[model samples]
Target: MPYITVKMLEGRTEEQKRNLVEKVTDAVSETTGAPKEKVVVFIEEMSKNHYGIAGKRVSDQ
Candidate 1:
């Protein structure tokens, strides 16, 4: 089985998240020779206040 994790900022529609998971699963399966059913993709979302860049929090920008 192949496990993949995608971390990004919060705020995405259900349809978008569905598409993202589908595409990511396909890519992982194709690259690792894992069956589609055996490929796992995890989506982790964080709020702007929880994310930071260049010494500044996203929420403050």
Candidate 2:
């Protein structure tokens, strides 16, 4: 089995997340020889205020 974890700022549409999971699971299955059913994908969405870049909060960008 292959497990994938994705972390990003919150606000993606449901369709976007679904597509991302589908694509990532397919890629993992293709590259790692894992069954599509055995590939687990997790998405963690955080508030922009909780994430930062270049010494500034993402919400400030």
Candidate 3:
């Protein structure tokens, strides 16, 4: 069982998240030779304030 975790700033449409998971699963499966059914993906979305860049929070940008 291969587990993949994706972390990004919160605020993506449902369709976008769906497509992201599907594409990521396909890529992992293709490269690792893991069955699609056995591939696991976790989406972790955080608020802009929870993420930062250049010592500044994304929410501030």
Candidate 4:
């Protein structure tokens, strides 16, 4: 099984998330030689306040 994790900020629409998973699965299956059914994609979304860059939280930007 090929497990893929994608972490990003929250608030994306369901459609966008679905599309992202589909595309990621396609790429993973093609490159890793794993079956599409075995390619697992996990999406982890975080709040802006929980993610930071350069000593500043995303929410503060």
Candidate 5:
């Protein structure tokens, strides 16, 4: 089994997330010879304030 964790800023559409999971699962299955059903994808969405660059919050950029 292959497990993938994807972290990104919040506000992605449901369709985008679904497509990402499907693509990631396919990639893992193809590379590791794992079954598609055995590939697990976890998406964690964080607020813009949770991420910063140059001491400025992402939301402010």
Candidate 6:
């Protein structure tokens, strides 16, 4: 089994996330020769306040 985690700022439509998972699963399965059912995709969403860049929080920008 292959496990994948994707972290990004929160605020995407359900459809977008669904598509992302589908595409990622397909790519992983194709490259690693893992079955689609055996490939796991995890989505981690964070708020702007929890994300930082250039020594500053995104929520502060």
lDDT of each: 0.94, 0.94, 0.96, 0.98, 0.95, 0.98
Error in Å for residue 60 of model 3: 0.6
What does the lDDT read for residue 12 in candidate 5?
100
Candidate 4 versus truth, CA RMSD in Å, comes to 0.5
Candidate 4 C-alpha lDDT tens digits along 1-61: 9999999999999999999999999999999899999999999999999999999999999
Candidate 3 stretches with Cα past 4 Å from truth are none
- Please estimate how well model 5 matches the true structure, expressed as its whole-model Cα lDDT: 0.95
- Model 1 worst lDDT run, 10 consecutive residues: 25-34
Which residue pairs show backbone clashes in model 3? none
What's each prediction's clash count?
0, 0, 0, 0, 0, 0
For residue 43, model 6's alpha carbon misses the true position, in angstroms, by: 0.2
Ranking by TM-score: 4, 3, 2, 1, 6, 5
Q: Identify the runs in model 5 with alpha carbons over 4 angstroms from their true place.
A: none
- What does candidate 5 score on TM? 0.94
Q: Which 10 consecutive residues of model 6 have the lowest summed lDDT?
A: 5-14
Model 5, position 4: C-alpha lDDT score: 92
Candidate 2 per-residue lDDT over residues 1-61, each given as its tens digit? 7789999889999999999999999999999899999999999999999999999998999
Candidate 6: Cα lDDT at 21: 100
Scored by lDDT, model 6 comes in at 0.98
List candidate 2 stretches off by more than 4 Å.
Answer: none
**Clashes in predicted model 3:** 0
Query: Which pairs clash in model 1?
Result: none
Q: After superposition, how far is residue 31 of candidate 3 from its true place, in Å?
A: 0.4
TM-score of each: 0.95, 0.95, 0.96, 0.96, 0.94, 0.95
Candidate 6 lDDT by residue in tens digits, 1-61: 9999999999999999999999999999999999999999999999999999999999999
